[model samples]
Target chain A: MDYFFIIDFVQSLADGLLFGTTYALIGIGFTLIFGVMRKLNLAYGAAALAGTYVGLGLFLTFNAPPFVVFLASAIGAGLIGLVVYYCCFRFTPEAHPMASLLASVGMLLFLEEMMTHVSHGMPHPYPSVLSGATLELGDIWIRGDLLFVFGICVVAMALLFWLLYRTPLGLATRAVSQQPRAAQLCGIDSARVNALTFVIAGVLGGTAGAMTAAAVGILSPIIATGLTVKGLIVVVIGGLGSIPGAIIGGLLVGAAENIFLLLRGVTERDIYVMLLLFLFLTLRPGGLFGSAATRD
Target chain B: MKLKSLITAGMISASALALSSAAFAADKTVRIVGFGASSGVVGIFGQNSGAAMSAAFEKINAEGGITLADGSKAMIETEYYDDRCNAEEGISVLRRIASTDALVAIGPTCSNVAEPLFGILQAKVDDAGDTGLQFPVFTDVAIKGGLAGISEWVFRNTPSEAKMYDDLFAWIRETYPDAKTIYGGVEEDFAHSRFTWYSVMKTAAEAHGFELVGEAQWLLNDTNFSNQARGMRRAEPDVVAISAHPFTSCGMLREMARQKIQPKVLVGLTSSSSLETLSGCANEAQGIIIPTSFAPVNDEAKAAAEAVAAKGGALDLHSAAAWENAMILRDVINAAGIEGTPDTLEADRRKIRDGLAALTTAHGLLGENKRMPDGEAVKPYVFVHAQGNAWEVVHNPGS
Candidate 1:
């Protein structure tokens, strides 16, 4: 019995770690936007989901291939990101940062309501490239779809890292993110850079949304708010504006959720997760990778 | 002189035609208002119910409407409001409806909302002390059992889940004699799911000689079910009963499949027998049985299904009741001699409530449905299994 219990515990951890990849992707989007603009995009998850809806519409209307669906989702989310930037972040005086935050919150509600209306709040079957595939390692099994999500997320993150480090555009973005006044004095277009950053984050968010939908094998408007909350939690846990922190935070949260659920039943599981969040907020506000000087 | 006479005759004829058309346009209408959660996860139910009501009213109107007390024709006109499945919103909407010319109202689709909405209705029929709203409400979708007993003014067209599950387990015992052990799963966050799983499914299974092996719980919006699946696997029960909506049910089922926990018999909640379940996880949900009141079994049911489909809504168990409720409204109005005028709004509501209470049996799409004294219905049901992206009726308890 003890051996079986241990095996179940291990399996739960494995399952959550794999599923956490989607969260990592979402967290990366939030972190990137915050990293560049020094402002939070509360509508990030909704915008991403809207992009997924666009992909779903095409898939339903034209029987589009999975590859095309992913591409459409990314492009759709990127476009929505630009709109979100203009509506929520761009016009607000940088003096009152709360205005942009409030505007993004409003955008979140609007997107959620709009999507619910369009979909009639019905859950749709998201097409999966690898449906119900599994990998077995003696008493433990890994979900095939989640493994695929992890792979895609890893590649996306690698590409993002490469872009931020190697390219000239990347250099301009880093300079703007680190010191906007300095970059502007050096003739860098801060506004254009910020817009590009949003576009990039939106693209990443779209991919994350699609991955999440595919991993769960279902999509519904109800998921928008929950995803937003989860993404926010990940960002907070991972260290605000820290990409690596988001990844680690996502995995930790995912694994911790499953482990707690197993140890304590479902009713009490979330309480523990919330307690963990509170602990982090109180004890380690700077997060695992963030510096104390970077505190918001 | 002939041309002048002809033109005079044409003008006189046109004036008469216009007068007749104006009189026809002035025909009185009986207003029935519907309010439910029309913009949330369960919005489909409200949208579908509203569409079914509209289709039903359209058909009634096309058949020359209903007969009023004075032998005048009165068309049924409906307006659907969005309560968003909130208790406060439902109460406010009901209050607004009471002030209107609406003879009757239908739903606040969620039970939590319906509970509070019913509380605000007049407790006793003619209690002068109670200032509760004196209105009649015919519920279609809020399927939590015994909600109608809250107020005499409230009536439910929704099915009696208690009786359905009792019958379902009794039938399961006879058919699957080898299913001796049962495992339970529920959406803990939802009142209906939790109550049905613990009070109904567990009791019925145990009563039918099935030993309780284990149980698990989850939330409606929970995405991962690995831990729950592991628990279900450990028990290895012969039957796995899950009381959850389509979303969580599909998620749990898929997780169960991944963990390779194959139970011999799978029983699902009443709400899980929906298109969402099929669309979300048909392959995983294959062979899982659920008892439901609505199926495209007979000609009337098929027509109701088509009518609702024509209105861009699928008539499932809950929405099908809306179609029946519309027909009931017409019959009650005719039998109770309702005038359906603005001056008689309060009297009309009282008459409708009396008519609903007087019903012993009502005509349903399938057949006659028994109307209990407490405003609940003993609806006809069939056991269906998920098969190839569709629910195929396995056993018709009615037949």
Candidate 2:
């Protein structure tokens, strides 16, 4: 291979790894919701973008700092998550999983259309905390904003890990995910736990969305559906309800996309990624960390 | 008493007849329909065109609308439908409009929808057996090079991508003789962006003695363009071209800036010459050149721009075409000399189509636009460059 090819490969890998953090964040959101509710929240991506838009509005209105904007986006997205649970999950018949899934899809369209109406489908420039800062390591140059996103992703995941494994809420969440009826019989409020799970996932998704916009340097209504699809792919590949699986799946998919992009062109990149998903589906069916049997 | 009652009844009957005739006269208004994605992700295109057409119709009606063959003046009225840039919705809206008494129709903003939608129209002028809809469609925004040729009943006032790029590259070759190497990327998922990049822009670049640097194609709506930018940076070309919608263009340009992939000359797709690009990536898009058919530099264009702005729309190349199309429809309505009546709707539509076919030239904001035999418009265009949050006119080849 030529030196240029090697350089391109290295660069793609590095960029993909950083971008994978975002995919992991989104995948974790899907996994968390699935773990507790056993249903896909297709509107999670749209809700994330809606939160980012709210943060952007705050930034535009009050000239808030980047950190504050991210904080506002997370909090706003958490509130939207509660609303989604109320509308799409809380009152729906739990016997049919498709009901909640379709309801989430409708919510997705509703939020996307609402954003389009409010913003007139215009893209806004997202503020960056580390704009124009680059770190060079020999021949490889890393973007500062991407590094910041990666760090944020790591800290967020650690916090989530602690919340899920080391806290009283974590124990309750695990108990509810394992046996909701038993948890309720044990005097635990399963509904409250489910709602809290959604709020947590929403916070992560919102942070992911804000970071993604900052990374891309623009935010628009167009990003919603694409992110949802990506998050779905990541969730499926990482296993339905496995947290660590989401991270690994996200990284694997991200690296694979960039590798394919370098080898083939962009037209064939998605084809390969989909092919990988197909392979995982046909051969494994349960994903990287999932068991042989599928969950409800 | 019987004679007095008969006289009262006679006066009442005469007054009722007069009022009925006056109401019939008042209802003889010319109606047109507009349909496009006025409410979705890419809603701005449809919204802008609809606003511009509405503004043009307002102006025309204010000055006394089209004069019919019987010397009766009719006011122009428009009904707009939101198709949401979907092909199925486009068909549904077209079918709905076909059942109405609309004289002509405009829009379905996306080229993908327009391609299939135009296919369902009557291809031959008078083929009765085909049974395709025979309504006259004057598209404004869908600019996929040869879609207007799909149907004889269909017409487009969009910019000719072939002519625009050919002229642009020729000008670039003359203006920048030292810019020999070209590197660019295109949003491959979009039909217009992909087709124009491969068929017109790249071919024009090579024909003008510029060499391609590396393979640069990215998916539409892709936020991360690091790999693409890094590849281009390796080539270090003098001229970089980006053929994409405003959103993708903004993302790519921002990535390029982040990667420090500076080219001496930056050329962009026609669709990127809008306020959206400036607002999205003003710093990164600085000095990017694009060929466009509309700019508010001239008096006529300025007036139309102001009118569109008043209706809450920004006048870009695509939207501005709607203004010219409305004027064209007015001219056709006058030249065809059709009586604006519901009973003669089909005949009026046919006459308008024929009138458009026979029209060789129409007034454009930049200059007189020449229409091809294939129902496409060849309007005068100027090259503009992004400079500090605005598109400054760099060259007017028309002059």
Return the TM-score for each candidate structure.
0.94, 0.96
The digit string of per-residue lDDT tens for model 2 on A1-296 reads 98777877888898888889999999999999998888899999999889888899888789899999999988888899989999999989988889999999999999999999988898888888675899998778889999999999999999999999999999999888888888889999989999999999999999999989999988999999888988989988999899999999888888888999889878899999999999988988779987554333
Residue B137 in model 1: shift from native, Å? 0.6
lDDT of 1 at B282: 86
Q: How well is candidate 2 docked (DockQ)?
A: 0.78
Q: What is residue A255's positional error in candidate 2, in angstroms?
A: 0.9
Best candidate (score: TM-score): 2
Off by over 4 Å in 2: A291-296, B1-23
User: In candidate 2 chain B, what residue range of length 10 has the lowest lDDT sum?
Assistant: B19-28
lDDT of each: 0.88, 0.90
- Interface RMSD, all candidates in order, equals 1.4, 1.0
Q: Where's the lowest-lDDT run of ten residues in candidate 2 chain A?
A: A287-296
Clashing pairs in 1: none
Root-mean-square deviation of candidate 1? 3.6
lDDT of 2: 0.90
Please give the DockQ score of every candidate, comma-separated: 0.62, 0.78
